[model samples]
Target: RPIFWVGNERTTDHIHSILTESEPWFEFDTSRLEYINRIKFWRYLLGNESFDADYWLTRVENDFE
Candidate 1:
């Protein structure tokens, strides 16, 4: 098996949806610092004013393409 860096959260989430909806041949690294930073970066870009995890979780997911 080969490891692929999916780049950002949206792609990761989209890939995750596909994986869970079917038989997945790939895995993701959603826990890495880079992934975390991408999420935060998006939040920053989107004017994330709420510090609540719940808000951030939804906000990040919504920012996904």
Candidate 2:
């Protein structure tokens, strides 16, 4: 059978796990889709560290509280 994310908790966990898989195929289409669909808000609020923690953290310290 197949697994599916039911609600928000299961959904978010599934997403994080999928990113960790880190397959090449996952990186382009799948990852981009994930970013656009689920992660876009983070990029908007956090910008790219949305994905990059190093850049993001420094940016936060410099730009935000």
13-45 in candidate 2: lDDT tens per residue?
A: 454444334446675667555544444455566
Residue pairs in steric clash, candidate 1?
none
> Residue 35: error of model 2 in Å?
6.1
RMSD per prediction, one decimal?
Answer: 11.8, 7.9
lDDT tens string, model 1, 22-51? 224423543433444555665587696442
TM-scores for all candidates: the values are 0.30, 0.22
CA lDDT of each prediction against the hidden true structure: 0.44, 0.47
Please report the TM-score between candidate 2 and the true structure: 0.22
lDDT of 2: 0.47
